[model samples]
Target: MAWRNALTKSMQELRIHLCQTSPASAGVRDFVMANYAEIKKVDPRFPVSLRECAGAEAKLTARYDFGVEKTVSVQGASSAAVLTQLQELIQLGEKMPKSGE
Candidate 1:
């Protein structure tokens, strides 16, 4: 029972973290995509794909084609608004009981 309690807590925490992180991460991704034109000007061959940016937490990968250039990677979290909403949703979810009691 103790182990079960711990497991449940852990799971809940994970869900909350994911819920909180996902939107912010997504926003970051969207920003990058929206600004791809500006970004590409810096590196014509920059890969501007959301999948490339999506990772465990929040990561971005840019492949530049500037003759002898290499892949550039950047990682960052989402903005405050996204984080706030996510946290709110997670808290709401936590308050609700699972189906079937």
Candidate 2:
């Protein structure tokens, strides 16, 4: 329970930081986009967008790659689930193959 709360808090904080303004948002976007392929390799549907929102809030959007054109929220409960999986993978020293393999 404690770890769960911590994870939620972490995600919220990250989103907030990213959406603060300018350089931060740009850095976050670059990092996420560069690593997006690796992230998707983990779940094949990781939240792929980190965008600035109104009044210092950030939005994380996920697209349904399977023909559905609707956008989905990747924060809150969803972020916890996938991020946890990713952290686990990292701790276990898992490696995703390079693109074009």
Candidate 3:
């Protein structure tokens, strides 16, 4: 039963981490999505969408002309890491070269 005890302990730790971080991650997701909508205004040709995944994971998709698209996702163990990943995606979108540029 020693292995069983170890497994249970590991699962408990995982649960604790998720409980502590998930709410903050959700907040970050909302913040990023709101900011992304503003970014889309600058170039409506490239639209963005946000997806919430199980656990503390978030996905952002940027669709380009001609049905081309790219997705950026972050499954962070901490709130700060999630925020950083979201910010990086925004910065990258801002730097994306326009067509024929």
In order, the Cα lDDT scores of the candidates are: 0.36, 0.36, 0.40
Residue-wise C-alpha lDDT for candidate 2, range 4-35, written one tens digit per residue: 33222222112212444444245444545555
Instruction: Please report the candidate that would top TM-score against the real structure.
Output: 3
Q: Give the CA lDDT, 0 to 100, for residue 61 in model 3.
A: 48
Model 1, range 1-101, lDDT digits (tens) per residue? 13222223212222111122455456555544454466446445433344432234553222211221122222344444433443444344445554435
Model 3 ranges with Cα > 4 A deviation: 1-21, 59-73, 76-83, 86-101
Report the Cα lDDT for residue 76, model 1.
45
Number of the top candidate by lDDT?
3
- Please report, as a residue range, the 10-residue window in candidate 2 with the lowest summed lDDT: 8-17
Pairs with steric clashes in candidate 2:
none
TM-score of each: 0.29, 0.31, 0.36
1 or 2: which has the higher TM-score?
2
Worst 10 residues of 1 by lDDT: 64-73
Better of 2 and 3 by lDDT: 3
Error of 2 at 94 (Å): 14
